[model samples]
Target chain A: MKHNFGAGPCILPQEVFKQASHGVLNFNNTGLSILEISHRAPEFVAVMDEAISLVKELLNVPEGYSVLFLQGGASLQFAMTAYNLLPEDKKAVFLETGVWAKKAFAEANLIGNAEVIASSKDKNYSYIPKDYTVNADSAYFHCTSNNTIYGTQMHSFPQTPVGKVCDMSSDIFSRVINVADFDLIYAGAQKNIGPAGATVVIVKDEILGKSGRKIPSMLDYQKQIDAVSMYNTPPVFSVYTAMLNLRWLKAKGGVAEIEKENNEKAKALYAEIDRNPLFKGTAAVEDRSKMSVCFVMENPDLEKPFLKFAEEKGCVGIKGHRSVGGFRASLYNALPITSVHALVEAMQEFAEKNV
Target chain B: MKHNFGAGPCILPQEVFKQASHGVLNFNNTGLSILEISHRAPEFVAVMDEAISLVKELLNVPEGYSVLFLQGGASLQFAMTAYNLLPEDKKAVFLETGVWAKKAFAEANLIGNAEVIASSKDKNYSYIPKDYTVNADSAYFHCTSNNTIYGTQMHSFPQTPVGKVCDMSSDIFSRVINVADFDLIYAGAQKNIGPAGATVVIVKDEILGKSGRKIPSMLDYQKQIDAVSMYNTPPVFSVYTAMLNLRWLKAKGGVAEIEKENNEKAKALYAEIDRNPLFKGTAAVEDRSKMSVCFVMENPDLEKPFLKFAEEKGCVGIKGHRSVGGFRASLYNALPITSVHALVEAMQEFAEKNV
Candidate 1:
């Protein structure tokens, strides 16, 4: 009866959860918990191998791309991407759209010279910047595909003269994109994929080993690619859960079919928010995130009652972020239409009662 | 019936796995997968808070110490610890015991000036270096509590004139230790705790803020400690499983009782290895790791058949690392006495036939 709409570490398919739970107990009928298995074992290696292959298959990634399941989440990638890609005297360009982008900028600044090509920070990051010029000889153009807290998304990708890398932590696999356009894409699996602890990095093989800096073995993308993501002990349980989630994604007719469902769900919720007088949407209409619908009520006092009512009606995690107080309904890929409908009904009832 | 002795991303308790699996499906009866919940949510905050509290209580950690559940395994800590604790001007003293300690030393060398106080590398790291001089004004003295690959342990901790830090990745909570002795302690949860993806960091509050170097938020132990390990999205499932494992440890009379059991298991396995003429123990008698027992046959060519026979007899993951070839029986906390008995029986049979 309950719906989960919390942002990243957001909703995952029920079947994925069920299968993942089963694996923890008896992984491939090994009588050992998935935690107990060796990453080097043929069984676990197969799991990593298939997980990477499926990621490539689902995204239509080209042959040269190598997928790595790393520890430390996408936040680590903020440092790693810059550390591996940014050359000694050159700088990287970053488009700051939201909290994640800002974090990436800070990490890049720490390691090497980074220029903010454009930023929506002046407007509290309510919209993604448009038509920013990327340096032709720069290391890469970094962007965040979706902003979870700000409820903003890049409607279209930036035209990068150099290699393009994205922190798709929040919006990976929600829709199809031209995989060829990106040289690197990293996502923390807590959002649309599986659990925390694993971050997926799909990097073009050729773009690696160009960084003159002596990268640590763990931080080196090329080292990880050569070992096939088993350079160090990988997050085995998380990877397995991701595989199950990917299986669920594939079963529901892949990204194209899921995109339709996602669009429909977002449309239903956004329609309710736009029509409702008591509530006001937070992000710019042109750049609003389909995955996360952020809004606030007219009366600040009504926020508590609205959230309480929503919770009582089995609509959970509707409260917005503290920085931008309101309500955010995260309609991730696994969030069913029924849940979105339930949220819409709650919003309507709240609007009528308050008005 | 399969035994998992793979060093890290290692074995976990069956009951812990059961409870964790259930939590992933319906965390705290909220009808949401643990993956779906917000990290800032009161429910998850409570989970992390309790996990930290349990760590303190179980280890009898002092009041000044803060516990953090971070991503990036113990490997990351090598760089982070050096970056956080060491100033650019002063050298950090390192005690190189095995492959892990060597890695730690290498990472420290990359970041700042580090002095190798003593190293067992000359002796192939068979034993711990003893009677080493401590650098008085060094940033901190670093050592590995248990060497996973070489199967060696620092039975008695070194007396450091400077602050002490230990990478307790392999043998954390295996025995009672004076937590106050070290300024910091870090362990990758894969081995003894629950699963991969989460690393446990215990740091004294007073020892921080010394390094003038600007550390990236993720690498800064102080930032993690300040946010109470919520600086970034933590490895939720791993932390929850660790909580379950800690509860299991508590129910079984805490570390004291577990240590006794561990010692007995190690004794049984080591005795068999010593008595068997066909097999030779890899580590020194006094420095042997209670967690991992490395051994090799008189005829190294017999390794394949020995491993096959062991696998057939339900002794799995016994093959040693390629760097240090042979067999290793990783007797982690969750490894049952029955499993060790089974391994010993297999080894005896192999010795009888092969010799």
Candidate 2:
């Protein structure tokens, strides 16, 4: 079997994939394909309900928080969240860590006003910015929990003066976090969750409907919440696959147990990068993401050779972001620790042969 | 065998469903599920490419038109189309035929200036409004070709002074239409296409990039076309299923052959509605939709019993839209004429027993 570590649209548990595939063929043995079933049907509605409730239970979400399965991914939410939350007079505070954070900031700025409280751009986003002051007049503080590109993650979420919004696109359900700490959270459900079709949004009910803009009905948070995420025939197949994946996550002891295994996998790869003579970890020591372990060849000349060696050993998707141009071993919740071991051994063997 | 006549999120061919289900489990025998594959990967890129090509081939899309598979359904396109085409100085001309047209006009009004040249709302949208003039300064003329709620359709598309945009959400692929006649066309895929997650947008390249508005990247037609609809991770499963359905459409002799069948199905049902003394059609004779055939019990008291009778006879989803409070039989391309015969038989049997 080949090992998969691609970032976002990445690997999923085999059981989840199998069950999802089975549903596609004959959901509940109704003799009707999931692709053909109406979303308004009681069967699919139950799927949506269970998916929402599972997300709440797994995250230990507060009573007032509502989870939504929406389209347009986290990139759209970069503006949609602002459209629903930020008024014309207020600015949003953003912590700029990498490419995704900058994109988020840009989209928010396009909609209205946004301020980058702090940025690590001086170092190509190798570290997380700290000690940034949240503006009192800000509508929300938006941050990316894990930088899929730079391999950095915020270990401690920043508290904002007015409200907090986090883009957990690459790291939701990978670890445990207090859902009560943030007013809103959105994640593109391709990494650490299910597929790429649906984006999951969890928000505190009290924080919505504050913006003065005439929000488009599809982008309006209040409209989605009122409709129970059934607003306009939600991405049914995507939501159903997400439900299956969430069920799989719950069966494996939820996020807490998944987090422990994730940490061990990250630790294994980072240790190899440290001990191997030809390899080096990329991100700042403490800020490195447990979900995405990035590293590079010390000589740069060995990059191609190491990649070739790893690929020959059935290790797939170890290529790093094009901007980074090294290697990123995304240790998402579904990736087996054995795959990390295989990569580590391959790296050591390549070093022994070349260096 | 149950007969599915749901308005949308409706039925698809059994062959397409089976093939889609198989792909979900093992896409191309790569041992990786379609949900797990990256959109940029050759496997899924081929999927997107084939899907676009099939749509083009089926519609006989001209060289200047580009087909894009986008998210956020046609409702988002209600604003997005206006955002991209309607300028501050010019108003969009809309021909209001039914609920969908009015909703489209309202959304365009929210974005910029949009005026309804004519409307059939005075008669509960029983017929299409002709003799509407497209203003000289109009940015574009918009219309809903098939009114899903009212069960009416445009027998002939209105010629406009400026550009033309149509939301053909319910009846897109069921019949053939000249692609060169319209500047832009969009449809939510839940109806005649595939599932609910994706929307198909076919736009004339020359018409875009003219609107003077800061369009959100997700909503910008030019940006989506430039990126070849991979601007973001698309609804992979939705696109995949649509591709399967489109493939089935082409193999079964494309839209031309399907239209003949659709017309026959509509004819059979409408003939029954006309012949039966207990039933009456809601839409005007010339404007009645071939895709959605709506009828009501003439006695009014027979509605409940007829519905129960039909349900007991394996007829599902015959309930009409709540707004109309009657029975609607949606004869999508995937639905066989035999199902329509079954529906007609059920109606005749019910009328005999009740009379």
Candidate 3:
């Protein structure tokens, strides 16, 4: 058994993978390849509808919110959210926690007025920014809930008077959050949902159409919501695979149980990083990510050897983001505690040998 | 052994489906699911490179052109093309053949100046508009090669001095076209290529960057081309499946051989439709699409019973689009001639029973 620790598109339940494979070959015993079936067919429609409804049910989304499964990933959403929400006169507020947050801010700037309310760039984004003030007149207060590169997560949400928009790309569904806390939440499904093709958007219905600019039909949130995410032929196979993942998520006791197990895995790994003399955690202790556990070797010389050692121990995708070097052990919801234990054991062995 | 005639997200080669399904379960014997692998992984990178190369080879894309696999389907491309190509002062010309064409024109109108130079809407889009002037000052002359809903197609080309753009979503690889004739070509990979999650774009490198507006980063052609379609995590599974289909296409004697087969399939079905006393072809004779062949019953009362009988006889997804309110038999590239013969037999038996 190999341990997968890469950030997004990292790990998923084997059951989900199996079911999705079955779907691709013979969807519902229809003898028609799922890849060949129409997206508007009753079966595909059911898949789309069930996927959307399960998202709502899993999140316990409030009634006023609309859930959308869209293409172009969260990167498309970075521009779409700003284009649809930011008006000409009103500026958007952003909290820059890491690389993705900075990119999100830049995308918003491209569309219209956007201001970085706070940033942790000075300290290399090792922690979430805590002192940002949200402008009452701003279109929305945008923030990245989890920094995938730096391995820091926002444990406390900022109390914003204006609309709150969160890019929960890496940490969505790993933990439960109050659905009413944010005006909008977007996540790239490759992380915690299913695959790379689908993006999930949870938007409060009232927050849209205020922007005066004519939105591209595909980028319009209201248009997608009105059509119930079938505004066009949706990414069918991706959505179907995502539905299988969602079914798996629900079967495993939903987000609350998964969140508990997630903490256990993270705690075991972080405990090892803290105790081992040869390694150190990268993120600030208080803001360490429960999802992606970033760390580095205390003796820089041992880095390559430790990585090779880990690879020999059946650990895969443990390398950190190129922007931030060393190692990153992403403990997503589907990554079992046994994998974390295995990684921890490898780390301990490496430290004992090196130090 | 089912006959699939749905317009899009339609038939794909059975071999492609099998290989893709296997990849989903165990990609390249890595012991990790394809859905869980990183987009930047060497395996996935190979998948991307091979897919791009195959698309280039299949289309005979010139050296100066870039082939991009993008998300958001053709609907997004409708806006992206105009946003990238249409300058602020110069108008774009469009041939409005059907519903999709009208929508494409409207998307361009939202971005900049767009003129519908010709339209077949006067005749319920039963025929392709032939008489159209491509103004010399226009930025580009846009056309849809095949009208999926209205069952019409352009049998002749308008040789414009300006840039030429075509959305070949429904009938791209069914026939051979001179790649040099168009500045850009785009197709949603559902019908003729692969599944519904990916779109293929072939753009001449010289036609971009003329528009003054700051194109949305995701929609910017230059950025996408520069990044080699890896600017973000693409729809990995979709693109991989599409690559498998492309390989299948190449293995089946490429576009030239497929075109002959497609014509034969279309001819057989159209002949049956024309000869049946209960049926009548919907599209004009010269403009009928070889990919999507639509027909209606001469006796309207027989429509429901005929459809029911066809469905019972191992025919699946043959329903007509709601807008056209008639049976549509889409014979895309991967649709076997046997399926066409089955459909023809169904129509003949139904005609004998009813008439």
For each prediction in turn, the share of the native Cα contacts (below 8 Å between chains A and B) that it retains comes to 0.74, 0.66, 0.80
Q: Which ten residues in a row have the lowest lDDT in candidate 2 chain B?
A: B16-25
lDDT of 3 at A66: 95
Against the correct fold, how does model 3 do in TM-score? 0.99
Index of the highest-TM-score prediction: 3
Q: Tens-digit lDDT track for model 1 on A65-133?
A: 888899888888998998899987999999998888989988988988998989999898898889678
Model 1 per-residue lDDT tens digits across residues B239-345: 88898999999989999999999999999999998998878999999999999899998888888898999999988888898767899889989889999999899
Provide the lDDT at B156 for model 2.
Answer: 86
B299-326 per-residue lDDT for model 3 (tens digits)? 7777888889999887766777777777
User: What is candidate 2's lDDT per residue for A128-192, written digit by digit as tens?
Assistant: 99877887878889899999889999999866677889999999999999999999999998997
Chain A TM-score from candidate 3: 0.99
TM-score for candidate 1, please give it. 0.95
Docking class of 1: medium
Tens-digit lDDT track of model 2 for B212-279: 88878888888898898998898888899999999999999999999999999999999999999999
Compute the DockQ of candidate 3: 0.83
- Over A1-355, each residue of candidate 3 has an lDDT whose tens digit, in order, gives 8888878687988888888888888999988777877777788899999999999999999999999999998889999998899999999988988888988999999999999989999999998878767878898999999888899999979778887899999999999998799999999999889988899999999888889988999999999999989889899988998888898999999999999999999999999999888889999999999998899988778889999999999888899887778999999988999999889999988877865
Write down the worst ten-residue block by lDDT for model 3 chain A: A32-41
Backbone clash count for every predicted candidate, in the order shown: 0, 0, 0
Error of 2 at A253 (Å): 1.3
